[model samples]
Target: MWFRNLLVYRLTQDISFDAERLEAALAGKPARPCASQELTTYGFVAPFGKGEDAPLVHASQDFLLIAARKEERLLPSSVVKDALKEKVEEIETAQMRKVYKKEREQLKDEIIQAFLPRAFIRRSQTFAAIAPKLGLILVNSASTRRAEDLLSTLREALGSLPVRPLSVKVAPSATLTDWVKAQQAAPDFTVLDECELRDTHEDGGVVRCKRQDLTSDEIQLHLSTGKQVTQLALAWQDKLSFVLDDKLVIKRLRFEDLLTEQAEQDGGDDALAQQDASFTLMMLTFSEFLPALFEALGGEEIPQGI
Candidate 1:
């Protein structure tokens, strides 16, 4: 599956487990349904839904895909408080006395406990790739908090999944602005039609442009006034297009062209073959693109002894 956004991280320590051992460990941590009165359950799961027969870890040589699932009961605090208030009012009316504040809070907890079991359950899945080969983990998300949730769950399963956010030598805003001003690309990248520039002020201003000349004198004027490029859209060769943000995250990725060319080259009519081909193409392309992109952003420098 293609990732729409990337939350890139670098592994801080060596991953000792090989594919087989990793798979077995993940199988031992397969996701379980939320129990009654349980707020949430977190664990690993089969990426492609093969159930017990399916390997919890999907390995493609050195690249591994770990799918994490979180099932949570949708019991809103407001709903519980309202129900508790109703119960408190009912008690007051029956006994013809006002309920104490502490007693009301106790009733609130009781209402929440009684409501959780029957609350509707919502399940969410986050798929992250472990490329111990490259010492990297790429989670398909733009939100750092959500990515951290996945990483934390993985850490609990593996006992020590030490990773840090991918860091770059140069600030992305400075690099992107220089690229636009010089009208030169970073290695294999080409400037696309979208960009976002922001003023370097406390109440900073923002400028977003689409389908406009990035190197035009008008755009350059903003750069002259200290408005740095916070986000720049670029295409990596003909394979991928995405916006590079200041936080080193890639967003709004489009792989339609790559997928179409791959589908035609593979010449597959069968659904299963097509699926396999898509995965193959993604693995081949991303393995190359990630390193290049990292270099373009000034390369990664992970800390020692994490």
Candidate 2:
């Protein structure tokens, strides 16, 4: 919690790619031009330049977050509006739906870049942000100790507004691998042990989950510093499904898919350090998961691999 010298942000990655060709397609441009750049133009920037060899890596930009001693109490909204006008869509910009649909994230990035550079003018010892679009307000020392006060005030100021309020968050500057591992093995890991498997007609052969809003032990185990995860469910369509903190949904996955994503997010393929979505999903399917759970519950075993 020593935030005096630290800076934190919870900025959503913005759209930093071209949408003109896609717009042209929507405007009845030739098929060849549109078809050629289908997936190519939708390229994503690799995190930390890991996939430099991949051709589509051209679509991404390295994150621009920085730690600075805040100098202003309030950011000038006029400044933000002038800079981010292009990012927001109105009736005029709505004509070419493809531009907005395809490049939504890119537009978000531009909006952040246009944010006013200020945090708070109030001397109540609460952290704030100039704009929610830019980075998160991670920590403020001369601020209040109540995290909810800081978050609630910010949300109240902007939640009802058309524009999203800039958020304030606190997180360690660790590698993604460490972050995933910590999440997977947190002390509140009851969700990993208590899972429900019901026979289903779905491709995965069954449904397994614990209700997030049940107001029970199962739901409480996986709660984060915030209710980051509202639900965690798994589905199999020759692949697995995962939703984390109600925000990160990993679907259309296979056994290898989990590891692949883990490798990408964790920044290492140690295999042993598999995170929850992939690790827990692997246990739910390939491991002797069903039988063990039934036995643990003091019920007749459902049969191995059930």
Candidate 3:
């Protein structure tokens, strides 16, 4: 499956286990529906959506694909508020006494338990690619919180995960601002027409531009006033395009037609074959793109062993 956003993490040490070992560890915590009174549940799931019989881990070359599924009961706060209000009103009117905070809390708890079984279930999945050779884990989530949740689940399943968020020696904001100021990017990368600029001062202003000339005088004026680029769109060697933010998160990632066309030709009509082809192509591209990106950002900061 294609990932639209990435929250990258670095492995502090080599992964000792193979794909089979990882699969067995995950199988111990397979995803299941939330219980009647449980608000949420989380566990590993089949990455290919090929039913329960499918493997939870999908391996290809040096990369491994895994997915985490979370199921949560949908109990709206508005409904609870309305129900609580009505119950409190009824109690107060019938008993001729105000409903105290303690009693109201107990009532709320009872109401929630009563409604939880009837609440609808919402399920979602997060996919991650673990590259053992590269020592990277790329989570397909825009939110850091969600990415961390997946990592926590993985760590629980594996007993331990020696990894941390990817960091660079150089500040990404500085590099991005410099690129825009010079109207040039590092080799193999082309600056695109979208960026987010923010003043460095506390409570300062922010400017977002889209589909406009980044090298124009208007953009230059903002830079002159001490505004720094926090996010910028970039294309890499005609293979991939994505927005790079100050935190080094990759967002709005898109594979160029050149790469996708090749995958399609190789995959034919089989859905599983297509996914495998696309994933292989994507990982191969990242093998090149990520190193170049690190170099451009002044290289990655290696983490100490756990």
Best by TM-score: 3
Q: Give the CA lDDT, 0 to 100, for residue 39 in model 3.
A: 98
Off by over 4 Å in 3: 303-306
Candidate lDDT (C-alpha), each:
0.83, 0.30, 0.93
Sort the predicted structures by lDDT, highest score first.
3, 1, 2
* Residues 198-275 of candidate 3: C-alpha lDDT, one tens digit per residue: 999999999999998999999999999999999999999989899999999999999989999999988899999999
Which of the two candidates, 2 or 3, achieves a greater TM-score against the reference? 3
lDDT at 30 for candidate 2?
A: 12
Candidate 1 accuracy as lDDT: 0.83
In candidate 2, what residue range of length 10 has the lowest lDDT sum?
Answer: 57-66
TM-score of 3: 0.97
For model 3, the local distance difference test gives 0.93
What candidate 1 gets wrong by more than 4 Å, as runs, is 91-101, 263-273, 304-306
- How many residue pairs clash in each candidate at the backbone level? 0, 18, 0
TM-score of 1: 0.88
Better of 1 and 3 by TM-score: 3
Superposition error at 284 for model 2 (Å): 24
